[model samples]
Target: MRLEGYVIVSGDGMLADAGGSMPDSLKFEADYRFFSTALDAVDVVVHGRKSFEDQPNSPRRRRVIVTGKVASLADDPGNAKATLWNPAGAPFEAACAHAGVTEGIAAIIGGPGVFAMFLGRYDTFWLSQAPRVRVPGGHGVFPGVPERSPEDILRASGLHPTDTRVLDPAADVRVTAWRRS
Candidate 1:
């Protein structure tokens, strides 16, 4: 199965501010549009409880919510199209199956812990960055941040970045898709 990650981080490698919320500085219309379009192409969306996407056709989409609430795989009480999964109790493939996703592209959306969970498994990680934004004393995209950049972690996981493309020059939003060899 093809697994991918989508994330936008600050210059300091943070995804959210100290309040456990994404800062306004990191939110760009261009970035959101890019993310929304990419997500539409994926078969299943895997994310933590707090990392859900709130865009068009979200409730109708197949989703696997990685959570500690379920021992294994369980139907999501909140959404009929979603499943609750605990990696400790079952393998990722099983969870994907429960979400009705067998062998297709799966997007990995996150809230730090989920990103770290699927660190080395990503076939392609589309990392978006706001070069002018820096969230100091904020939540990082990965577990070992402030000590290491997100690019460093992806490289260590055997992923190489392609040429970056500017999404919003005014907002300094740029994206690079890191693919594993």
Candidate 2:
């Protein structure tokens, strides 16, 4: 399966606010549309619990939420659209099967650790940066990794910038897709 990462960060490479949530200052309609479209193109979406919870339940997409529990949404009474998976307890392939995702692109939209989990595995990283916003003391996109810059982090994982497009010039938001060379 082709694994891909989708994230929107600040100029300083912060992915979330200090409160462990997406920064309000980085919210833009264009960016939201871009993300929504990308997710629509993918067959499976993988994200952390917090990111999944923040979004409204709709369209019932096949999704996997990284969690500590061994149970899946199939086992849960609520949220039949998603599956809760613990990578340490269950294999990724198994999780995909449980979600009924047999193949195609799997988009990893995250909160730090989930980003790190698919670092070298990601075929492409749709990295969006908002230059007008700066989230000081916010959560880094790769929390455990020691890399100083997001570019360096991706390069270290063997991915290089393939293309960059300005999604919104007025907001100074741009998206750069990094892929394995």
Candidate 3:
């Protein structure tokens, strides 16, 4: 199965503002467009606990959230779709196997540790690079990994840039895609 990740980050490498605020309206729209595009191609969506918690209720497709315990959305099941799994015992590969995603696309959204766990296994990466934003204490685009040029990391991850376009040339946000060889 092909596993991937999709995220939007500021030029300074901040995923969110220092106060944990979300992207601006325009950025949010662009992000949603990318997310929707990814969802349409993938049979299942897998995300870390933080990503799951940050999402609003939605009942559109099957989603798997990797966490210590199975997540519950009973209070709003009508709007929340997808299942939850704990990746503690089983490795990420096993979890994907359990989801029956033996082929096609399987996406893993952010939360650095999760990315690190599955980076070597994915076949693609869809990254939205926003223009520089100054957030002194904000979270970075990729945390935990050793510091290196984004290009080097992408190369080491077994992925190479395949396409790139400016979502808003004036704003300097470019959405790029990389494919595993």
Say which candidate scores most in lDDT. 1
Candidate 1 per-residue C-alpha lDDT over 1-181 given as tens digits, one digit per residue, 9 for 90 to 100 = 8999999999999999998888888889999999999989999999998787789878778999988998999998878899999999999999999888899899998989998888889999999999789898999999998699999999998999977889999887899999998
Residue 165, model 3: lDDT of 74
| Pick by lDDT: 2 or 3, better one | 2
Better of 2 and 3 by TM-score: 2
The candidate scoring highest on TM-score is 1
lDDT score for candidate 2 against the true structure: 0.82
Clashing pairs in 3: 58-79, 63-82
Ten residues in a row with the worst lDDT in model 2? 52-61
The residue-level lDDT of candidate 1 at 93 comes to: 98
User: Model 2: how far is 6 from its true place, Å?
Assistant: 0.4
What would you estimate as the lDDT of candidate 3? 0.63
> How do these models rank on lDDT, best leading?
1, 2, 3
Total clashes for model 2: 0
Question: RMSD in angstroms, all models?
Answer: 0.8, 2.2, 4.0
Each model's C-alpha lDDT?
A: 0.91, 0.82, 0.63
Q: Alpha carbon lDDT of residue 2, candidate 2?
A: 93
